[model samples]
Target: MYQKENSSWVKHADFTICDMLCLQLAFILAYWIKNGVGHPYETELYRNVAVVMIFIQLVCTFFNESFSGVLRRNMLEELKKTFEQCTLVCLLVLVYMFLMRVGSDYSRMILLVSYVFYIGFSYCSRQMLKKFLKNRRYEEGEKRSMLIVTVSSNAKNIVETIRKNNYGTYHLAGIVLMDCDKKGKTIEGIPVVAGSEDIISYIHKNWVDEVFFAVPKEITIPEQIIKDCSTMGVVIHMQLATMKSLGKNQIVEEVAGYTVLSSSIRIVTPRQMFIKRTMDIVGGLVGCLFTGIVALFLVPAIKIKSPGPAFFSQVRVGKNGRPFKIYKFRSMYMDAEERKKELMKQNNVKDGMMFKMDDDPRIIKGVGHFIRKTSLDEFPQFWNILKGDMSLVGTRPPTVDEWEKYELHHRKRLAIRPGLTGMWQVSGRSDITDFEEVVELDTKYISEWCLKLDVEILFKTVMVVFMGSGAK
Candidate 1:
């Protein structure tokens, strides 16, 4: 079911390598300019260090989202991300030097100059390349191949937007109707070739480069349609309630080994799975390394105050409705679960399924309040992440009891693995009093989940933890 597009992977690979080489050369030039006659030193150690540093920086640059959707990115956004990535690289270099105990070996002056020059030159290079590509595509009459997969008013609006924009780059290939009633007709001059059932056949027959889905959310097509399109090697775009409501940062993921249709902005990609796993491994290892030290200090304090186990384990719903034991530093009394029923009448929250009490009396003595407030209770979940029952970022898993109460729609949150921290946790854990709001946020996160989003959430999570905002 695969067909080739005008752009080839070879071209992409060549462009990627060229960009990397250009950046490397820019770094080298900056180094020379900064060090002058001492530029070409004969130290093998320095050369080895330089190679390793450059490789690490390049990888980090990619991870920080330096080279993504190069064609469609806005210049301003690209520049901002570039500046941030450059700063990150500089900081890494400083950290690397400190760790290696060789801060004196490398010239600080050279590093500073390289940082400035590399950032400016790299940004300019990307901008110039973007403009050049845009011009070339225009000159070559390289129109963006697009296929509309709906016959709704939303589809009409999408057509209107494409028409009004008049960028001359996008060419409407055809439209596929979600409902069979509109089959064998044309909408606004775009041919309605087939229905959702025949979309695979239609795509195979046509030279479609991109597929635009404007189908209503009520439609019950198998999620496989999106995955089929992705596996068939086409870029898929969907129109949600409003453009603003669309999380541009939502990630497209392959569910059940098939790519599901998702919004453009995502937290995880097939390409990023490796990096995410690596991060989980490294982060988990580091966390495990400190687990003993933390347990030692906190265990006795908790026992002294609460007279209970130092750790708490509870059954939480994980990916695919699976139940798993989640570990935490015991933040509540031994009989906290038993006391939940007694406090139900005093519950200030009113949500469909979730239970919450801002001022619950179930908390343990000294450490319970402190640990819960700072989210130190969640640190042990790093073991869960390491064990692959969870991730560094994903929807928060519900309690087993909570899972039993979930509606079918809410079960969609289990479509992906649960996380240690998530959008809901960072946004407003305690303040977000509505269970539906929590589910909505989770759905939003899943629909638009990506590695970048994970990174952003992790960053926000750090801020939230430090600020102790919305913690109970």
Candidate 2:
């Protein structure tokens, strides 16, 4: 997985901290220059005014996106935006002061001084930072070194295109040729450093920042190379072959100056992604607390009945077929895996890709039945959510064995992190016996996914749990 660099949440947080600190510092400096240090807060009204001004300024900057641009390319524009934001903040403060009948209590001179001080200081500081970044990128050689992975003919076009774009962030490093015989060849002055077979090893040994797979449509990029890049945390961008039809909301992104159609399933903004993760963290905490309380009542009963561990941990395929151990309260006997092979003949699911039985003999007697009915068995997975291995809502993670049987298209369910509860769970998990139907529901969830849909699914899950539907 390519970890998003300079993520929006991080940028916003940085700008917010900088703006707040600068605003408060500007006001303090102005106050000290005007009234001297002895008269910090002359009146209780002054303190109230200061608080209100800070609040209003933060609100204005947030809404105006005053601090949302890249500093190097946006110095003049950002300065103007900052001035407008500060002016708006002052106007709002004046209106608020009038409404509170404290307009006379605060100094107009201080406001005028602070406004000028803030604009000048903020602009100068931003320009200094911009200069520092520019120096670091160009003078200090901080630009990311990119490797283009393709044949000689395609590599020439990609190299030309990238040079034409003049993207300053990434510098051309070399190329990886698909044809083994062209290992020592050069495409548009960039040497072919390695063949396809040695690409992964070469990347591991070198300081390559990102790799662009621009192979022809007929050539298949090996899955191992992608997995290797993901594991090593080296960013990978694959060129999308021209297609007649693409999904709604599909994005075309410029990666290392090459225009590639982004095939992301997440149709969410950066703010939305931040909010979703925050929700997952909060929900996971609450769910874990509930799980702890419930465990007090259920653990002993489960142990007494099964005479083994209260929780079961199994290796499950997670996002992008990455494996992680999934935790659940042990609802089956210790011999469950042993019994599974014998029970394969009795598998009810049409495809045998998944196993589900109405009266599974492997389930521990009373405790298993009770927990399964009420969904208490799923509580331990909140830990997984907290660990970032799972989410509060997504497709169910499949077992390693089950995943091995998956068709290429079936693996699309792993595009997002698996969830504790999802469309499949709420939509009669037990009643739907066919594995294909499960895949269909999972696919539908991915295609139409949003925060609103997650909330709706959560509500439906609550209802389903209350009704004890499909708990068999």
Candidate 3:
């Protein structure tokens, strides 16, 4: 599959971290220049101030997107951007000092000197890092290959544009001519590799990871070619750099060195995803600890009641249909799988896309009923969250058989990683019996996912668990 370039701060974190380091170096130098001190941060006052400054740096660099285009900026641009960011950090610190009435406690000269030194240090480091990154990522050797498709008339301009604005991740593999064969011909020295008829064959034999289509307004891309590329797991990005939003599910993204229209289930910033994953890791760690404790107390009782393994493992579909072994406390008898077929008639869901019954006959009566009611059966999934097979909040994972029976539309719910608790789980898990309603809630969660929405869902999940009403 075309490994979509990493979505977030992961791509440009080096510069952000380097800039913060530069500020620390600047502060150290400023301290020495002003007081000839051995270590400013060793003092309680300066140590506390240093911590606050670090927070300000985070706010300025990450939250404020100060390094949004760091890799693409030229030396002069980097100088301007870095200087502006450093000034902003100092200004925020100044406001903090003023508000706390501690202006007299801190040395103004040290602050001014730190700002000046930070601007110079950060700019140089950023420019050098950017150059090094461009060399390593784009020019060192082989990179992800990109194939450009367009009419012969538009080939030269599109090639020039891609070269000018390429994010340096994809090297031009060659071109494919739609209007006519220009095979063995070079547009801006990028050879025309194929023409309309043989493009698919050429791609089949080549290592093209992504395709960029930049046809004229009047021309249309062949549906067959698009399907052929997609079937081979190659992403086709249509050049739409000069336009604005293209409505729902259409995202304007920079791909293969060109701004293209990428259709996706959701479009969110890398920073937000970074934060979301961070939250998952933190929550997963805590959940695992609690799961261990709960298991100690619950496992023996479960074993005593059912006389089977305390843990249950089943292969379940995860994000994008990737399969993983999902774990839950053994909440049902050993023969539950075999018994499910006979029990299908009693399913609560109208369409039977999902299996839920009023009181599952297979549950190990007392212990199973208690765990399911308390939702403790799902605690083991915290390990899945840590492994990234799941998220803390997402669509419920369907059993392998249920997944196999799903219609095309139902697959959208699994576009994201399955979660321990989710929209449907929080929205009256037992009452909402319609599988379509489950799909609706899951898709709504995916489409409208944000930190705020996730927070609200998490809070509601806590309430639901405490109230003892979960999956029927």
Candidate 3, pairs of clashing residues: 8-270
Model 2 ranges with Cα > 4 A deviation: 1-242, 254-259
lDDT of 3 by residue, 1-472 (tens): 6565653466667777898899899999999999996889888767777788889998777755777766667777877777778988999999988898888999889899999999999888887887676555555355778999998888889888887666577789999988997799899999999998999999999889889988877777779999999999988887654444544667666988996777677887877788889989999999999999999999999988878799999999998889999999999999999999999999988877888888788988888988898889999999999999999998889888889989998999998888988998898898888998999999999988877688889999999888876655
Arrange candidates, best lDDT first: 3, 2, 1
Candidate 3 residues lying further than 4 Å off, grouped into runs, are: 1-57, 60-216, 219-247, 251-260
Best by the TM-score measure: 1
- For every candidate structure, what is the RMSD over all alpha carbons to the true structure, in angstroms? 8.2, 14.1, 12.5
TM per candidate:
0.68, 0.51, 0.55
Q: Pick the candidate with the highest lDDT.
A: 3
Best-to-worst order by TM-score is 1, 3, 2
lDDT by residue (365-409, candidate 1, tens digit) is: 567899899888888998999999898898888888778888887
lDDT of 3: 0.86
Residue 24 local lDDT, model 2? 74
Q: By the lDDT metric, which is better: model 1 or model 3?
A: 3
